[model samples]
Target: MAVDQGTFRRAVARFATGVCVVTSLEGRADHAMTVNSFTSVSLEPLLVLFCVEKEARFYDAVIDSGVWGVSILNPDQRPAASWLSNRGRPLVGQLDRIPHHRGPETGVALLDGAVATMECRTTAVHEAGDHDIVIGEVVGAAVPASGPADEAGALLWHRGAYSRI
Candidate 1:
């Protein structure tokens, strides 16, 4: 028997996952959304994937742009993560309140203080149930010159709320 959506979601919530902000550009406007579904797909091809609900506004922007940026959030960036995840947020100037710089490869906003950032070009898109899995080829990436410190943990999702570990 197929499990109900609620049961499936609740079960998955028990597994912790890191959070990331995926950004894309539509004309001069920037689009972003907080997602915990980002993952490294392959090392040989330098590929990564992030899942976005088909109806989300950022979905179309990323699909049309064909390029995007991923900012892996640090523990201190929880506020930015929460803000970007909100629905019905203003489309324009959304990144103004958050400190960011445009990625050299994709021109998408990459949040300041991120543990790591990647600029990627869409390699393939596959429809998954209610969401689309966007696989990208990593064109560029950055991390702090000193690298991530051991004590500086990542922002994570657990049991429907943000956590640090």
Candidate 2:
């Protein structure tokens, strides 16, 4: 039986998660989207996972490139996340509006406002529900906001709105 939409929505929404913008380069164009489904799977081998909607325009890019950059959005970058999440919004001229640095490996745009960024290579992919779970091994990562020796920062999503902890 199908679960009620409202019930499922509320139930899942109860578990808050940090938001991120996963990005990759498609030829000369850059694509990115807001994702709250990012999670840490392991640390020994440096692994993490995030989901992509099956039909999203950037799906093929992620598959074809085999590499992706995940930027954990700081509280100030919420507007960028909301904007990029809107597909088919004429992104040709909006690239300059985003403050970013290109990843040396994939050349994907890494937002500067993020507290941390992870560059991952696709290790495994699986289908679940209507999304594809893309698991990656973190090959390189940087936490400039926290300094070379710091590992702490203000986290943005808590239970709906942005919260610092």
Candidate 3:
């Protein structure tokens, strides 16, 4: 059975995921992109995964780069996530405006006040659909500034919005 693209997209949008800004260094320049395709793959060795469009400018940055950071957005960070996700808008200039910290593992920018931080090393990249699923071995991790003990936050998407349970 073939699923219509629009229907499949809308269906997936209904299944909201945690929002995050995946970042890496492009020399002295930094690259950031909003992503909701993140998930924890394992606990023993500490692993995580996120999908990136094969055509994204930062796709290679994530793949070829040795390290990266995933800054899990707080509920209030939806706006920042939306902006970073926008391909129509340039991201380089806005990065300087936001206060950022570099992870000890990756030297990638971790969004200030993010709900959580996960630093990872690229482990594997598998081709899937129009995206590539990149898995990372967790190197360094942290709780967001003032984050709750249970660690609650909002979920975001390209279409609709939803609150975390």
Best by TM-score: 1
Question: CA lDDT of 46 in candidate 2?
Answer: 92
Stretches > 4 Å off in candidate 3: 145-152, 162-165
Candidate 1 residue 103 Cα shift, in angstroms, is 1.0
Clashes of each: 0, 0, 0
Q: In candidate 3, what are the lDDT values of residues 88-114, reduced to their tens digit? A: 677567577666899887788988878
TM-scores of all predicted structures: 0.96, 0.86, 0.88
Ranking the candidates on lDDT from highest down gives 1, 2, 3
Candidate 1 achieves a global lDDT of 0.94
Q: What is the C-alpha RMSD of each candidate to the true structure, in Å?
A: 1.4, 2.7, 2.4
Q: Which stretches of candidate 1 lie over 4 Å from their true place?
A: 147-151
Top candidate (lDDT)? 1
The lDDT for every candidate, in the order shown, is 0.94, 0.81, 0.80
Query: For residue 111, what is the lDDT in candidate 1?
Result: 92
Least lDDT summed over 10 consecutive residues: which range in candidate 2?
Answer: 146-155
Kindly list the per-residue Cα lDDT of model 1 for residues 45-100, writing each as its tens digit.
99999999999999999999999999999999999999999999999889989999
